[model samples]
Target: MAEKFDVIVVGAGMAGNAAAYTLAKAGVNVLQIERGEYAGSKNVQGGILYAQAVEALIPEFRESAPLERHIIEQRIWVLNDKSYIGTHFRSDNFNEERPNRYTLVRAQFDKWLNGEVKKAGATVITETTVLELLKDETGKVNGVRCDRENGEVRADCVILCDGVNALVGSRSGVRKEINSKEVALAVKEMHFLPRDVINERFNIQESEGVVIEILGTVTEGMLGTGFIYTNGESLSVGIGVIVSDLMKNRINPSTLLEKMKSHPSVAPLLKGSEVKEYSAHLLPEGGYDSVPELSGNGWMVCGDSAHLLNAIHREGSNMALTSGRLAAETYLELRDKGQPINAENLKKYNQKLENSFVLKDLKKYRRMPHIMLENKQFVTMYPDLLAGAAETLLRVDGVDKKTKEKKITKDFRSARGIFGLVGDAFKLVRAWR
Candidate 1:
């Protein structure tokens, strides 16, 4: 006889661990399976972790989770070849009793989360590949078939917490395979620096960190961005581009990263650092328009599998955790009401997402991805224009302020034309709305 579980959560990623921990703590017999050797083994790159979503699941996460440093500064930069126009927000308020964000190494963080899941009584099986979803004669998913011998396991329902690829979901016909245009390929490297050097270079205390989000030519005019995050003793730097653009241009992601690291505005930051780790992963950048069906009979999808990533805000893990928690809560409510895990009952999960900020934020920026992808000027022409204008205005070379202002206007108009500039602005406004 096959072992039965109240819920079987596939992929022990952020979403999987969150859902499995939530369900197990609620007295549900949950089986969590991971294809990697351990949770987070496939994801070693450093990234930001939003406190609100994490605290919602594990209220005392900060006490034990493998957090690197609390973010006290955030910088957004638009780069030209040799110069960058940037804005930074830094506040001592971020060093308060509970910080809003932190830099974390995903491998250690996920391992910590897996420990929490086990503590919550979820049975976790590592190195297990779930081949496909098992459906009954009525076309309702009821279990999963794994790669191992007699690897069929029954469950009241299954949760697809798979990453951006959503292999199982796609194979089971739950969601369509992601298009290259709707995803981004991000390559990251962790450069090791002494703790004191990191602190001195970033002008931060031991517990504080800085994050830099770069735009413009760094992506080679692609619709993507580059980033640098400060960890305890390392800097996480990376560049990403839309997969479609990469394929269309035959641009190698590694070459682009190398160029980004060599840029004048970025090179000094890592002058003497040693590269300790390198990894790459796909990110869902489709915004709201590309999200597929989230729930069906006896199954639901969360995180990247559901295309819940909000690329505009660089918010993925938080959205994943929120969606996972909401899915678990929805299932628990249904079970309490004596309802079966069907398409009708799982609609509550989608409803919960709609009521939360997850869907609301995604809806707000629904047009951003398309606009950014279509308008190459934001990453190409505008950066040069802004840099030139700033230099012309600042370098007091005996030129009158009025003439310099006129020269800036003429240069912009000459490059983009008036109609192009107006159209780009209009599109940007529409997308931000």
Candidate 2:
């Protein structure tokens, strides 16, 4: 006879861990199955963990989780070849007791979270891949099949927390396979830098770090973004491009990252830094337009598996954690009321998400991806043209202010043409609105 769990959660990433942890804390028998050699071993690289979301699952997690650094500053840069127009925000309040966010390496964070779930009475099994869902005669999901021989387990409810590949959800017919355009291929490298060097360059004290989001010429006109995040003694720098664009352009993501690192505006900060590791992963950028069925009879989807990433803010882990927690809460409520797990009841979970920031923010930025993809000027013409204009205006050539203004107008018109400029402006405002 196979063992049974009150709830079976697939994929031990942020979403599955959150769901299992919540369910186990409620004293339910939860089994978490992960395909990686260990939890998070599959996610070779990623960003910092948002404080509020993880803290919501484990209130005192701060005291125990292996956090990298507290983010005290954020920078946004629009880069041209030799110059970047940017803004930097540094706050003392961010260095206070309880920072809003902290940098994290996914490998370490997921291991810690899995341990927490185990401590909370959940059974965690790594190197165990969930093959497919087992349904009863009535076509209701009851359990899952595993790669291991005789590895069949039953549960009242099953959660699919898989990553972007998300086979379980697809196999169960909960959602369709994602298109290349709907996904992003991200490449990142960890550069080892001395603690003092990081602090000196980024201007921060111990435990305080910086994050820079770079756009424009860095991606070589590709629809993507670049990022550099400060860790304790290393810098995490990466660039992501739409997979479809990558396929069309025949440019590798790693190559794009290399180009960004070598760009005149970006090279100086990374000078003398030693590259320690390199990794690439898929990111869901489909926004509100691509989300599919979130729940079904006795089943639910969370995290990248459900296409929940908010790429505009470079936020994925938080959304995953939030969705996972909500799924677990909904399960507990239904179980407590002795209600049956079916399609009709699981709709409540979707309803809850619609009212939450997860869905609201995605809806708010629904047009951003299409807008960015359509307007290459945001990535190309604007950066170079603006940099040239700035250089021309600031040079001590003894030119009059009025003459400089006329020269700038002529330059803008010459670069993009008047009609193109107006069309771009109108498209930007319409898309944003």
* 245-266 per-residue lDDT for model 2 (tens digits): 8999899988888889998877
What lDDT would each prediction earn against the true structure?
Answer: 0.92, 0.89
Q: Candidate 2 regions off by >4 Å?
A: none
Off by over 4 Å in 1: none
RMSD of each: 0.9, 1.4
lDDT of 1: 0.92
* Lowest-sum lDDT 10-residue window in model 2: 40-49
User: What's the TM-score of every candidate structure?
Assistant: 0.99, 0.97
* Per-residue alpha-carbon lDDT of candidate 1 for residues 176-251, written as tens digits (9 for 90 to 100): 8889999999999999999999999899987899999999987888888899999999999998899999999899
Worst 10 residues of 1 by lDDT: 40-49
**How many angstroms is residue 86 displaced in model 1 relative to the true structure, after the best TM-score fit?**
0.9
Best by lDDT: 1
